[model samples]
Target: MVGLTYKILPNLTAYGGYSEANRAPTPLELNCSSPTRPCILASTLISDPPLQQVASHTIETGVRGNLAIPAGGTIDWKAGLYRTSSTNDIIQLASLVLGTGYFTNVPETLRQGVEAHASLSIGAFSAYINYAYVDATYQFSGTLSSPFNPYADANGNIFVHPGDHIPGIPRQQLKVGGDYAFTPEFKAGFDVLIVGSQYYVGDDSNQNPQLPMYWVANLHASYQITNNVQIFGLINNLFNNHYATYGTFFDQTTDAQFAGNPVNFVSDPRTITPAQPIAFYGGVKVTF
Candidate 1:
């Protein structure tokens, strides 16, 4: 990795960086190669058909500055752009069994994004906002065959086309928050986070319905009782909005069962886990 930074003005700075990274496959990926002989949990499995490591190259650039406000406060802002490409990217393929999957490698993948944030403070009151937009997609064309492919035909094969959006990754997100100091001993703040939707796993062809976007709110407060003692409280998921951070659809039933008496059994093909509900936490901090 390499980086460079230059001060363009008294309060402004510009920076850029480049990095290369690699990741080796795990033992599970190396061993799980055939769908016919699925390894159940708690069973012994040996690594077979060694896998290749994934290699990535990335570049990023950004600028940030602080501006003095007429009211004796200051505003800080920054913006950045980044791009990364990876070869032989390892990915998980859903299996016929629920909560189980195998790993495979894509020929290539790309992710590029923009990010910006700004914060303002005028006296005890302050506010900040941040936003990011990502374009993540596969850069290779091929066919993926798996027992869990939701779009598979009778033979269980799904075609992966270039530019398919990777599943479970939000393409856009935003966060805005502000805090006010009631006094030297007390403060309160709140924040809202928004996440955009993307394609679902097992639907790499981009033919399935995408997950819906959602947002959540959070609140926090703090008070100091003495120079060395303080108390804080937090309430997350203020509205209790239901959402899922990750999700995928697959047929959880085995092939033999489906072939024997397909009409005698009913299966819920889509599985989803819900996000945490509204919760509260409080704590005290003490310093010597």
Candidate 2:
């Protein structure tokens, strides 16, 4: 069967919209002594009980299209509008001191963001890229409320914290690749990927520079020895370029929020050492 189709219309598409906040679960939330009311600091309701940190809002809208090249192949394109708040660092929220016996960092966080992605393909080659921009902060309002002991400050008051940006979101990413067959029996392909900087959870040290830019190359090849048999091999870290997915020094978290917990969040979010060791694999296949 053979067919051809093509069309160019308006670039109009959108999502009704979506929201996400306080998504991260907090220790205070886990420490919920009661479910009906706001968990308390002592026996009284604290301003805000540790909840999934609190991301806030997200909007998604976009359009996409496809084209057929008759005997050729096809091409596709896509774009969109998106907004999202930083997610509360639920994992880090384990530091809020709910009470003398209760200490956790279920601090509320507020983050707003925008994101986009696009890609295209033709013949045997295809590629795509994605990007996200986030604005974040922390919330000190709204106190957690509970009946156990009643959460309250020395002044005996309840309030909620705003929210902050979520850590660990990469701002930009680029990936491109293509495949070509040298012969009907042998084919090989490769791709190059570039990743923008990323931040550790809770580390807003702009001066620290986002995770460094990193680029990596990957390659693969396959050969058919016979009609019923095939062989293949793959090489990773082809460029041998030094890079790190997570920074060099990883921090667990230690700070006042933990009372005495260490604010050891992963620092040096880069490859201070070097990229992973080169890796390669090969195999042969036979069919009956």
Q: Identify the candidate with maximal lDDT.
A: 1
lDDT over C-alpha atoms for residue 270 of model 1: 52
Superposed Cα deviation of residue 111, candidate 1 (Å): 0.7
Q: Per-prediction TM-score, please?
A: 0.85, 0.55
* Candidate 2 C-alpha lDDT tens digits along 58-117: 566555665666656665656655544443444322122332223334344544455555
Score each candidate by Cα lDDT. 0.83, 0.52
Cα displacement (angstroms), candidate 2, residue 75, comes to 1.7
Model 1 misplacement above 4 A: 26-45, 97-99, 252-268, 286-288
lDDT of 1 by residue, 1-288 (tens): 999999999999999999999988767777774454445662436665667899999999999999998889999999999999999998867555544555678899999999999999999999999999998888999876545555787666688788888877889999999999999999999999999987766778888788788899999999999999999999999999998777666655545465885563436455567889999999999999
How many clashes (backbone N, Cα, C below 3 Å) per candidate? 0, 74
Runs in model 2 lying further than 4 Å from the true structure: 1-16, 19-57, 68-73, 86-89, 93-121, 124-165, 200-207, 224-230, 248-274, 284-288
